[model samples]
Target: MKVLSGIHEPTKGTITINNINYNKLDHKLAAQLGIGIIYQELSVIDELTVLENLYIGRHLTKKICGVNIIDWREMRVRAAMMLLRVGLKVDLDEKVANLSISHKQMLEIAKTLMLDAKVIIMDEPTSSLTNKEVDYLLSSISDHESVA
Candidate 1:
């Protein structure tokens, strides 16, 4: 796999993105090439809000001279938009610990969308959801792919 470079011979087969081979790219460069992964076990911050969990410290780049400050308002708007895009309607200010499992999963996806990635890999995202919830999620993914 290109992720781990287990294929050994990079020249034999190339993993290309935007016409560039992934095997030739550095780890950080490859990571930044629009690939995002969401693990089955979420490591979200319990104390932070849904919006804060999504943006973390990156929300402050607008007003802050350095990376030390966070622009709460901008982050909230972006996080809210991402939540809307993922079809989850939750209070962006609510703590992650208070959210239900389904809501948490949606929030995690919303966070991924906020990163503006071209590829998103979800691992067992609906393993624990109810039938209705799973249907909704599958439908959403299908709808997105259809449009794409």
Candidate 2:
């Protein structure tokens, strides 16, 4: 999972996806190739709003006059839809720190779903969650599978 996600580059062997060879890769390429990982250790930033966190590292933008300007409206709409798909409703402007752990987890799932990844690896995602949270999380993942 790590190698496919491009967290590491194989030293002695090459990887092929769709007949493409890759000896060295990075996370950017992973996303480009429709691969992503959701670590057991969630990477939700506490200081950022739910909206901000959802778009972290994957901000949508347009270049105008050689300046990259973020497309806030489009991102907001997509973030809301992703959260809804996960059955997690959150105040888009709410800070992540103020949310419950479950909400944070849901937010993380929403973030990954928004990435349009073909495959996602979840690492012990239920360890810190409650039974109800786990149930919801699993159901959400199942729902994502149906959509995908």
- For 5-103, candidate 1 gives per-residue lDDT tens digits of 232446655678777665454545544776655667776788998877997645655535554655677777777777776677789888999988888
Taking every candidate in turn, the Cα RMSD to the unseen true structure, in Å, is: 4.3, 3.0
- The deviation in Å at residue 117 for candidate 2 is 0.3
Per-residue accuracy of model 2 over 1-148 as CA lDDT, tens digit each: 6787778767688888779988877888888988767777779999999999988777899888999999999988888887877778779999999999878877887788788777777877667677877787678677454232
Off by over 4 Å in 2: 61-69, 143-148
Off by over 4 Å in 1: 1-14, 24-27, 63-69, 141-148
Native-referenced Cα lDDT, model 1: 0.68
Q: Which candidate number maximizes lDDT?
A: 2
RMSD of 2: 3.0
